[model samples]
Target: MEFTAALREERLVAIVRGRDPEASFRTVMTLVEEGVPLVEVALSGADALDVIARARRELGTEAWLGAGAVLTAGDAQRARDAGANLLAAPALGPGVAESVRQGVPVLAGVSTAREVAAADRAGAAALTLLPGSVGGPAYLRALRAPFPDLPFVPVGRVDTERAGEYLRSGAMAVGVGAPLIGDAADGGDLGDLRKRAARFKAVCA
Candidate 1:
């Protein structure tokens, strides 16, 4: 499916930030098996590019693959070359412009209206409220009230139970990391991960 349509339909994105390439790949595969339409491999840890490449080759068009924690122009280009259909960053910066220039859709992280406006100026495809749990559903609702037309995705501290609240509060989607993908170092069970993915899908649905 098209990235935007998948985002709209699934209303959930599994963010992979694990350091182990094998574990990350397994997590993504399990998410795919469980019906997740979008997955993001964050660059905050090692082997992110490799994991993204693996997911791209393995899942092909089955899922919308993206790279997160993109903080520089070089990072943006590298992610694009590595087969990331989209890019996400913690804030609006020159890297976002680079991603746009490279024809990669991007979600810019923003916490306030002013930042949201800046992201709009930068031509972001959407906005992600970082550390979303801090603000909770009420915070997202308040932010969306002013920019109801722009898509808003909440990342950080968003669990399965809170996913529904965020969506109902007007989030275009909710990004869950460790809680959804589980810890790679711990070698979490794939069966359990599938079950969590299904639960998340049902809640977001």
Candidate 2:
């Protein structure tokens, strides 16, 4: 499947963001091995591009690997060159334009209709509501009302317990960070990541 198609189909994206690149890579491998469909590595961490590239090399073309927290065209291009199929940003920025130019699917973070419209105008594949736990599923429902046609992926603080609620409330998919990846960066149990990924996948289903 294509990037956007798999995103919408899976209805869940495992956000791999940790300070330790090796831990993050190991956690991502666990998720993939346990059947988690989509994964994105945030660029804020060290050796992020390396993580993306490694994921592509290890998981092969069937994997839906992407880059997150992208803000600039250069960042988007770097992600693209590293084999990122999708680009996600905290807000509408030059990265979205760059993704469009590079034919990469994008998920722009947004909180309001104005930002949603702006992201749409910039040609985003979907809109991810940052701080999703602040307003929870209710906020997604309200925001989704106006733009019924657009795909919405709610990120930030989303866990397994609430994944279904967000999807039930009309979000196209949900992006999970620490809750999904666990504390792998701090040498926490990597085995738990598989369980978490399975639970998340079940809920998103």
Write candidate 2's Cα lDDT for 91-185 as tens digits. 88898899988888899999888999999998898899997988999988898888888898999888777888899998889999888888974
What TM-score does each of the candidates earn?
A: 0.95, 0.95
In terms of lDDT, model 2 sits at 0.86
**Clash count per candidate:** 0, 0
Against the correct fold, how does model 2 do in TM-score?
0.95
**Cα RMSD for candidates in order:** 1.4, 1.2
Error of 2 at 197 (Å): 0.8
When summed lDDT is taken over every stretch of 10 residues in candidate 2, the lowest stretch is 184-193
Candidate 1 overall Cα lDDT vs. reference?
0.85
Best candidate according to TM-score = 2
Which candidate wins on lDDT?
2
Compose the digit string of candidate 1's lDDT tens values, residues 13-50: 88988767888888877787788868888887678888
Off by over 4 Å in 2: none
